[model samples]
Target: MTDRFSQASGTSAVGGVERRSTRSWSGVAWPTLGVGAILALVPLWLGDSRVMMGIAVLGLAFAAYTIAFNLIFGSTGQLFLCVGALAGIGGYGGAILADVVGLPIVVSIALSTSAAALAGGLLSWVAVRRSLGVIFTGIVTLIFALTFENLLLGLGELTGGESGFLMEAGRGTFLRSQIPPYYLMLGMVLLTLFVYGSLRRSRFGWAFRALRDDEVAAELAGIDVARYRIFAATIGAAILGLAGALLAFTEGRVSPTTFGFAEVDVVVLVMLAFGGIGSFLGPILGALTFTVIDELLVEVGQLRVFIYGALVIALFLWLPRGVVPALDDLLRRRRAGS
Candidate 1:
């Protein structure tokens, strides 16, 4: 892990001073663009099938969520389990603002995203201030997730409760279209990748790697652990919120199931685990792989969650750090042998 971080961070000692290598940044940028370009070609093949295209858009949204979650859990050691809840805030908040309050869609999305970000930041602050461990942090966040769901149900008049809330803001726009929304979601995924890659090559990434490796050591080395964790959570939550809001507008509805904990959080966690935590392409790969798997598992009906649980157990037992990091290690070893 230490060696991997050192290499990815591109640090070199010269005359007792640490310098970053531009090679790493270039390496990251090209691959990111290549991946984006490849994904951009999906619509060419699937354009005719409305159902498939819709599913693809949803897959892209999950990819976006994985990226945001990767930034929070993969970057820092923060074990936040409220991924769905935070996104629910964005989706529901945007729906209420745009449909009920008569606010513009853009304004509603912005405000909702901001609210999610603030909520995430506050959650992180509480965790840090209380010196919560990973398990305790997860527990707290899980509780918050449940609470958010109950809150939505309790305020049925506003949120539309179990029946869900129908949104009319982007009804007549391109958001309701199959192709355009797919591209919009794809663009969001690409933009998130760019931002994530940029961060990985910056000082922030260095700090994140440091803290993740060892919080006490990172603090001793002069990194502000609390501030950086909060920043990551806030930024990730903002992305989650924005994605959720856009999805709500695109679907023209907001429902508890859309951002339910079991629906979003569990899936995202599995995706991140499969992708390799903290690896640049991990989230995208995981989301793509699992999206296909999930689609196939639709036939199983109630057994899907059971399969997911089994997969999680299997992954943690055999490939705990995920596919990308394991493959990276294998390649490095093979090169050394050569």
Candidate 2:
């Protein structure tokens, strides 16, 4: 009787814990659903197709790039600046493979993404061999960006050099216009968010965080720091490559001018820093805010970049942890109060 009672009590406790977990998730879900509903209604309310499509496309692309950046920098604590170059490679490679080799867009995109992953792995291997800090990583990646740009510029036959190539309109009946592209981008963003969330909750995520926190200690704990770091870089690069391919398809063109190196790194860094580099939601928030600000300041001409730079500086000085962290803290406090 005692043993039976003990087992019953344990089962009851387990059930209670699960119920609490469900409630906690519901708390998060309701707010998310409410916000999503409001956003979804905006296009209908405004009835401006162009504005809606433009916002959707730009926001989605920015989010994709930011997520790729976060995979390495936020999770693995590695600073990299080659994302734009790799993305450009993916875009050009996909376009050429699809146009010249007669491969399907999907197949070409896969090939390009795979190539980018391999390149990223190789670069990570080289980077691991040296004890370069974040600044050094930025410098090395900047050199790579320059090299890639110059190489593409010289390869007039393949890349079309400065003139660029105009791809055939639409791949199939499914992806025809701005609306379709917007939906596709939304799907990719959701998929990436799911993948990232799962990854953060997995054992590999723990290993990554361990390495990020302290490489020496992680190594002592029998964690393969170098391998994990390389893995992060490779995966991050693949995402960037895929994002690039998507951008190419959306724009229906590939060009050297699209992947300029000068301010790419700064934009990425600012987004990551402003959104809170420690959380999954940081990149999304940062990307959306930055893209909106950028679009709003488009009319400012040359002064736009200066304004962005000032805002970044102000963010750093005032809220070093970024917006998401601050919001998260507030939420936690509210929950505690409730």
Candidate 3:
């Protein structure tokens, strides 16, 4: 893990440096890419396709989910709360189109992704028209999320209602073979990281940050706050939408339970909080740490739930910005003291 961090990132706090390094993109991305390359082969190394598949699917899906979440909530400071709903739109839309409408799986997923992006874009446009503030935006989106879930439940015949959507074995590309799904996941995650890294260093990212810091000041500086927010929402929602589509394959079905308030969105949000929101690799690290922690605690039964909750509280109390930021601060302080 240490080596992966060192090699993938050229950012440094050692030698009295207190900020990210001015490394080229390749240098900045090497560590993450290296780790991903190794992850790609874990199925062979672990000798248990099932175990490896579990790791890859869950980790990659949530990593993608959190990446989108980080872009809106963390980077741009838009409290866009309809993440799971948008993902569900993609998941259910894709599955129903594929299973019922008999569209090709790829086409279904593409349309579903587009639908999710359209939903996000519409929400952004509405929010801008209403001149909604952060809290109002969150409220409106949360309402949309709740409404979406109910919409699925209302369409009981189509969605399978309380029983959930049932996917037969060997249904989707993600289930064709464990290896294929894992590779797909690995590819998506790496691509997301690369895209995010590039975007973070681009003009869009700068505008996003400027909006995050001070909207009024950004507006004065000629930043079109409304336009960029919409861009973030559309792109981020599109990413989440794709993840949702992949998720249908991951679980072999679609369900409201899979994309509800206490499920997908909250999990991704917790991951972002634990990993240091807005930092490129923070949520990934957090996802890894918590997923392992959850797996380890499974044997402890219900006690693990309490433990997990306690840990989150502890994190907020002592390390509010998350593990990575705390470590960065510690390193900077030590260097200053020295």
Candidate 4:
């Protein structure tokens, strides 16, 4: 009896060690290091300051927005279509607060983000109460977006209407300069990545995943399904608001045209789809790839959108799991063979 017990214990200990070693080797840290190294080398290879800076700023903004989308679509299994509209609300709100209310840019941003988050939370509450599916959610958000655009157009005095608000004294400083914006965006991206990483390791993340897999089962397992869903939406919206604020500051202006349905739909869907939607890196990969492609094809003018649409459709048809998952699978297979 003693010998049998000792043998079992010994096997368990050895298995545990092996498992830990394997996980340590195939960890996020190594992947993160590789990504960082690549980013650091980008400036050295890309001599065009304007292009590089534009890419960095746009990438960072889109990354934030995509991450926010992941919190709802990827994590909570909720499909939200108003992400762009919420961001526009944040942007316009910040601009108004700064320009009209005489608030500082930073304070205006904070206030604007908070307002958007609150609105998002309210929307989430409505969705959760009704148990709205993806289709309904999309419809609701689309209506909200159209309403916002029309409101902006009708209220020309406050929003500067169709002409848009121009930043006079606010423009041309280092705060508005390319390098400063790039560095600021980089810092924000790092912060967002850390926040998302930590969240995924938390109890909330587990609950969210469970809810995503089977909401009824998760509820039976003691998870508050509605609560988790609402929390996800609220958190996602807050991140979106922050991204919007950053974009507004970067552009030195806020305009209704910026939050149009077409742009919003293409960006949000492309980012989530191109990214694997399985891991934190998925959205990052999607955002970076989309931005690079868009920049490269911008010279093609009107043909660019058609090309992008075709590429996206092709990707969906050929690689449904997306670029990241396919590449990761290939890498894993190669490693296994080696």
Q: Per-prediction TM-score, please?
A: 0.91, 0.84, 0.87, 0.86
RMSD of every prediction: 4.2, 9.0, 5.3, 8.2
Give the per-residue lDDT digits (tens) of candidate 4, residues 22-45. Answer: 223234445455666676556566
In the predicted model 1, the residue pairs found to clash are: none
Better of 2 and 3 by TM-score: 3
lDDT of 2 at 151: 88
Can you tell me which runs of candidate 4 are displaced by over 4 Å? 1-48
lDDT of 3 by residue, 1-338 (tens): 11111221224321111145434566437756875977777778753667757666777788888888877677666678888899898889888888888887789889999999999989988888898877898999999999998888998999998767776533644465667777777777777777776777678767766676677888999999889888888888898898888778766878898888767776776777787766777777777667777778779998976876787777766666677656866887798899
* lDDT ranking of the models: 1, 3, 4, 2
> Model 2 TM-score?
0.84
Best by TM-score: 1
Give model 3's clash tally. Answer: 3
Q: Please report how far candidate 1 places residue 18 from its true position, in Å.
A: 13
- Candidate 2 yields a Cα-based lDDT of 0.70
Candidate 1: tens digits of C-alpha lDDT, residues 1-338: 23333222222110001244533656566767888888889989999998888888888889989989989987887788999999888889999999899998889999999999999999999999998977898999999999999998888989888878778788889989879998888888888888887887679888888887777899999999999999999999999998898888888888889999999999999998888777678788899989999999999999998999999998777877676656666776788799
Clashing residue pairs found in predicted model 3: 7-31, 8-30, 8-31
